[model samples]
Target: MMRGGSNVSDAQLQQILSDVPRIINDPKTADVLVKRAEELGQKLVTERLRMAQARDIFDELRQIESIWLREPERALRRLHLLRPKLAYRRARVRELGPLAEVLERAVAEVVSAGDAAQRHDRFRRLMEFMEAIVAYHKFYGGGD
Candidate 1:
């Protein structure tokens, strides 16, 4: 389970558990991100993803990037903070469903990467994933 993400109900937990194997070996992380990022962006469009929510998460990502440049270890801690927020926001704003799902996956990727070097690589993937999602979201006329 992700740190501070204990709020997942039994149903959601079951769904995620079932997704684990597919998520684990469906291709390398970078390749999967490349293939699915656009689809996720489009999914957000279908979900009517809110601009304010996207902006807030994006801004937090930027902050995490800056912290990463300065303190690599601390950056990981900061990244972990997103788990709880994703859970909370997903509950409060239904439109955040797709966005929260993708973000949660990214965080899980980073958390399970196993070591500092691996985590760094996963973090880069996470960043790239979000950038692609946001770009495609805007391209798809996703608006507030």
Candidate 2:
């Protein structure tokens, strides 16, 4: 049986957040990323987190990633803004539950990634992780 916290018993998702950089560095990382996300997706489904809730959060993250940055500070400001937006979203969509918990960890990682270069890398990995999560969430039958 699945074991760990209600969100993800062992904080596997949290590990995935912190491991993004190392995972990106590994020569054999690509499939590892997908495999990990797929496992998390199954857990998400088993926990009954809904697809819409996950997608809505992803949309906000995507918007942040897609913005053009003439000044790097603008991107950081946006990232800072996302934290509260996520909090408001989680409060509104209680069904988000563990998924929000997981996303929050990722946001924390991105915000504290230490420097501009590292932050950008972490952000991309965060996007990849969430994209895989959303795709696998749909693949595993998560729905409204």
RMSD in Å for all candidates:
8.3, 4.6
Report the number of the highest-TM-score candidate: 1
Q: How far is candidate 2 from the true structure (C-alpha RMSD, Å)?
A: 4.6
Which numbered prediction scores highest in lDDT against the true structure?
A: 2
lDDT string, candidate 1, 88-111, tens digits: 999999978767876777688777
Q: Which residue runs of candidate 2 sit more than 4 Å off their true CA positions?
A: 1-32, 68-71
Report lDDT per candidate.
0.69, 0.71
Off by over 4 Å in 1: 1-31
- How accurate locally is residue 38 in candidate 1, as Cα lDDT from 0 to 100? 58
Clash total of candidate 1: 0
How many clashing residue pairs appear in each of the predictions shown? 0, 2
